[model samples]
Target: MPKSKRNKQVTLSKTKKKGREHKEAVVNTMKQAIENHNSVYVFSFENMRNLKFKEFREKLKSTSRFFLGSNKVMQVCLGRSADDEIRPGLHKVSKLLRGDAGLLCTNLPKEEVERLFNEYEEYDFARTGSSVTEKVELKEGPLEQFTHEMEPFLRKQGMPVRLNKGVVELISDFVVCEEGKPLSPEAARILRLLGIQMATFRLCLICRWSPDDFELYIEGPDDSDIESA
Candidate 1:
């Protein structure tokens, strides 16, 4: 065989092997993300840009939750063959994810997924997607029940609500910070306090644990996760 041809065959084999390995890793991550989850909240940051994306990531950082990897990477992390409709439908969300955009795979109890991303999104960061850019649905439980808990967080987060398309809705909008950086230290205090205060005032997501559960998660949300501050 010619030297160039031999090299080409070797390169091709390596590329194919790498692709398989990447897919397997994605499948595994997806599996690990749902190992103990009650619900799997799949949200796509498809149209996110600029400070909006940074701030969105910062919010997750503050909570010690992060999502990284491209759509292809994530696809491979989650086994592509587990379910038929899921991966393709999820890919549609993943496709919207360009540049720094990503999917958040969490195991913080499926019951708490909506409350994490959408509930407090308006104030924590800007939003660019619409029902068209991204889709929303509850795979389990009553999505409506979460609305009551979510509404108050919206109020505190400084997001605007509109009767978009004849339906009352809390929609995303731009919020530019004063210096084009994250909230100031003072502001961070206020945000944490605001979230905690809102949690207390509304009793939202404030499930009372027994002594054992309390000890298990004694650190609280800010402590439990890697927070921005």
Candidate 2:
């Protein structure tokens, strides 16, 4: 008799991966954005903050659409090569979607988009495993910022602190974080408690694509050229 197939282990190659439908939806949405908007941009970002990004998205909801997801999916949506491109020069834009990048499809003028992208920046709290950019030290003194109830919590975070006359006092100088070092879980929590924000979230435009032209900005574009595009 053949062994029962029930509860049998399956080979990895035979196991189906999920999210095909989701990737298809993303591709469809991107294609629609390309059709609906006058221009599309490839932009790179640093220290992405979801809530702040959501707020930024809300501000441009009426005139612009942003897509942030799998780079491979985005590339496929735009087509990887000129032969398969959905639009005349979109494949050029797709080639720029390398790392920490996204798409912005908009009807706004190029000048306005550039100005907004250059001016927009947000400061957010650093997370664990994020590199510290500055030294954060707490001098030996009374920490008026924290209440007596926070004493135990501070101590658990490796802070040399105690409750003194209902105020949290640092018994000795404490270095919460150091520059050029990766933040630890306790260091992140302490920095949050102290209201220190080390992460700067910003977006930079890499290139622009329109029905008529394709422009790359890394080496810089002439003012006349940008205006004409």
Candidate 3:
């Protein structure tokens, strides 16, 4: 009824339309990536770091390209059913494009692809809302890494701290984070300050498609096996 309400609905509608367009774009690009490259490898990744992943992409730009986006869109690009298959045997490989995975299109050999994936690992601090991989606790003692001036800020991060002479000391033992629990904003900050890296970025090849002979190879566990597990 109101102008503000109508404007809000229009914004929401635009946002939804934009998201659909993005998915369609990813599907088109993925199809192109499959068509242009010699081999297509579907790789699963966890805790992806943007900067490190970008660096890896830049390194492989000359000979390869990586496409990461919605798994459903990727599956659609590869063809979920025979009727809409992108290529002769792409539907078989598309079935393996599940979970947190992306398409890696390259002209490199299998050994080279495996080696590059292995070497491109990234370790970084976990973000807010990420599950803590390990329990972290700080004992009540002088924190030599910090100065007395940092005590106030440290206290704001839910740490019990006070200035002891010229150094910062924890007033009591604090559990910075608990394993398997979502990290809070304060917890993530404290973990960073403690130099704890809780996120590991790695990729695993789940499937491969060779265009020359139009063959599909499913690696690791296939969809049926994963469903049973």
Most TM-score-accurate candidate = 2
Residues 1-229 of candidate 3: C-alpha lDDT, one tens digit per residue? 5576645543445443457777777777777777788888878888988888888889889888898766777778878776788886677667777778788889898879878777767899999999888999989999999877788999899888888888999888999999999999999998888888999998777767785543333435465643332
Quote the RMSD, in angstroms, for model 2. 5.5
Best by lDDT: 2
Task: Give one digit per residue, the lDDT tens place, for model 2 in 63-93.
Answer: 9999998899999999877789999878788
What TM-score does prediction 2 earn?
A: 0.84
After superposition, candidate 2 runs with Cα above 4 Å error: 1-18, 219-229
Alpha-carbon RMSD, each predicted model: 20.7, 5.5, 4.2
lDDT against the true structure, per candidate, is: 0.38, 0.90, 0.80
C-alpha TM-score for every candidate: 0.29, 0.84, 0.81
By lDDT: ranked, best first: 2, 3, 1
1 or 2: which has the higher lDDT?
A: 2
Instruction: Give candidate 2's error at residue 41 in angstroms.
Output: 0.2
